[model samples]
Target: MAAIHLPRTIRIGGGVLDELPEVLAAAGLSRPLIVTDAWMQSSGLLARVEALLGGAGIAARAFTGVVPDPTVTSIDAGCAVLAEGEHDCVIGLGGGSPIDSAKMIAVRRDRTIPELKAPHQEDSPGLPIIAIPTTAGTGSEATRFTVITDAETDEKMLCAGLAYLPLIALVDYELTLSKPPRLTADTGIDSLVHAVEAYVSKRANPFADSMALSAMRLIWPNLPRACADPQDRSARAALMLGALQAGIAFSNSSVALVHGMSRPIGAHFHVSHGLSNAMLMPAITQWSAPAALPRYAQCARAMGLADDSEADQSAVGALVEALHRINADLAVPSPRAYGIERERWEALIPLMAQQALGSGSPANNPRLAEAGEIEALYRQVWH
Candidate 1:
C-alpha cells in the first residue's frame, strides 16, 4: 500500500470559514502568523479574519507580501515577519501562492532556499499550519508539497515531505463566490487536471483512484457553472470540494507531466499555475494517452464525457476533444495570445525542459518524457 497522508483535520462546507476560531482554540494555537498576498489584505478578508481572531482573544499578524509564483525572497520576507512575532502556528489564508509560501516558511524558517530545496528527513516538526483556501485550485492545503521559486535562478522548487503538510484545512465555498470568470475557469480546469493526472500517474493506487474519480465527477459538471456565474453558491461548493478532493488525490499519487511542464512556465513567464496546466493538458494527454488507454478512458467516463460502455480508443479521443472544447469555452488563451513572445519562448525551451525534468514530476508520468521530447512538446505548444 502506498502510504496515505492528509491534513489532520479537514472541515468542508459553505460556511466553514466561520469555524476558524473554534478550530484554532481546539488546537491551542494562538498568536499565529497569517500568510497571504497583497490583494487579499487589501480586500478586507484579512481584516475580517483579524477581527474574528481578536474577538476570540487570539493575537495574530498578517504577512501579506506573498506574490503569485511565490519566490524565495518572498518566503524570506514572510519568515522575517514570523520571526518578529511570538507566533505559535501559521495560518495560510488565501490562494495556493500564500499557502505554499506559508508551508515553506513553516519548515524552513531557519534555513536558506537551497537548503530547503534539498530533500532530507525532518527530525523536528515545523510549525502547525491551518490552511484556508480562497481559490479552487493548487490543492496546496491538502498536499505534502510546496512550490517556491528561486529568486536567483527562477526555478520553482518542489519541496515535499510531512514537514510541508498542513495541520488543518478549512474549505469554505463562500470565499470563492467573488472569483472572476478567468480565475474561476483556470482554477476549475486545474482541479480537473489534478484528478486526471493522479488517476493516470505511475504511482496510482486504489485509494488515490477513488479520490481522483470522485473529484472528476464533482468538478467536471460544476466547473463551467461556477465560471459562468460566480454567485452560484451550489456550484461554488461543488467546485471547492472537487478541488480539495483532487488536491488529496494528487498529493498522494503525485502530479505528472502536465504539472512537471507547467511549473517551468509559471517560473519563467509568470503565468498563473492553473492556466499553464490547462495549456499543457491537451497536448500532454494526447502524447500520453497511448501509454495508458484504459486509464484515460476511465477518466473520460468519470468526467461524464463518455459512457462506461464506450471503447477505450473512443473514450480517449473524446477526452482530448473535451479538453480542447473546455479550454476554448473558458476563453483560455494560447501561449501566443497569452503574450509570450515567440523568440523568447523558443530561446528558453531547452532551459524550461531542463527545469521540468529536474522537478522529478515527469518520472511519475505514465509516458515519461525525455528532455528532448519535453523540449519538442514545449516547442509544439508555443503556437
Candidate 2:
C-alpha cells in the first residue's frame, strides 16, 4: 500500500497572508520564529509580517540568515537563533531556501548533519512550521523534503521524512506577483520538472499520479505567461497552485534522475536549485524518455504538447524537443555556457557522480544508471 502525507491545513488565495494571526490562534501557537532570507527582510516583508503579528498582540522574532542553496552552516546559525527564543513554532516565509532552513532548524537536536542524510528517514515531528511561500517553486511548503549543502564537502544532502513537512501552508499568489522574469522562469521550470520526474518515478502511485498530471496541466501553459508578464494575476495564481500540486506530487512519488543529478550542480557550481534543474532538464529528459516512452507520452499529452492520436514514440520525441525548446526560450544555460570552467567540471564528474548515486534519488528512475553512465551524463550536459 502506498503511504500519503500532507499538511494539516492549507489556506490558498490572494491576501490569505493577512490571516496569519488567525492561523496561529487556530493552531494554539503564540510565539513564532520567522525564518527568511536577507531579501525578505530588506524588502520590508518581514517588518510587515511582524507588524501584523504585533497588532494581534503576538510578538514574533525573525531569523533572516537563510541563503540560496541552504547550507549546514546556515541551518546551525538559524537553530542557534531558535534556541534564544520562546518560539513555539516556525514561520518559513520565503522561497525554498528559507523554508528548508526552517524545517532543518526545527528538527535539529544536536545531531550531526551526516546522521540526517537520506537512507535514514526522520519521521518524528519537530516544531510546527507555518509555511508562507513567496515563490511559485520548490514547493517546499507542500513537501516532506529538505536539501542542504555541506559547505566543506560540497555535497547536497537530501533529507527526508514527515519532520520536514510543514504543519500548515499559506499559499498566497499575491506574494509571487512581484517576482522578476528570470526567477519566474527558473522556478516555473523547476515545478514542471517536479511534476515530470514524479510522474515517471518508480515510486509513483495512483494518488501521486493524479497530482502530477493536474500540476502539469496548470503549470505547462501558465509558466510562459507568468514569466512574460509577472503582473498577470491569473498566471501567477495558476503557477502558485500548480507549484503546490507539484510539491505534493513529488513529495509522495519522489523525484528521480533530474533531481539527483541537479543537486550536485547546485552544490559545486553555486547555481540556484531551480536554475540548475533547468540546465539539466533537457539532456536528462532526452536520456530517460527512452525507457519510459508511454509514461513520457502521457506527460506530453498532459502538458498539451501532444494528443491522443499521436503514437507514444513520436509523443516522447515531441516531449524531449519541447523540453529543449523551453530551455532555449527561457534562456537556461548549459554548465559550460553558465561558465563553469571546463577543466573543473571534468575533474568533478567522478565525485559528482558518486554524490548523485549516494543521494538515492537516481534509483527511483525508470532506468537506473551506474556511476560511469552518470559521469557521462554530466559530460553530456557541459555543453
- The estimated TM-scores of all candidates read 0.98, 0.99
Per-residue alpha-carbon lDDT of candidate 2 for residues 127-151, written as tens digits (9 for 90 to 100): 9999999989999999999988999
Report the C-alpha lDDT of model 1 over 1-383, residue by residue, as the tens digit. Answer: 89999999999998888889999889988878999998888889999999998998877888999998899889889999999888889999999999998888888856776666625434356999999999998888999888889867778988888888899999998998879999999888888999999999999999999999999999999998988788999999999999999999998998999998999898888899999999999999999999999999999999999997899999999999999999999988889899999999999899999889888889999998999999999988776
Candidate topping TM-score: 2
Best by lDDT: 2
TM-score, cand. 1 vs. native? 0.98
Clash count, one per candidate: 0, 0
How much lDDT does each candidate structure score? 0.90, 0.93
Worst 10 residues of 1 by lDDT: 115-124
lDDT of 1 at 301: 96
lDDT of 1 at 193: 93
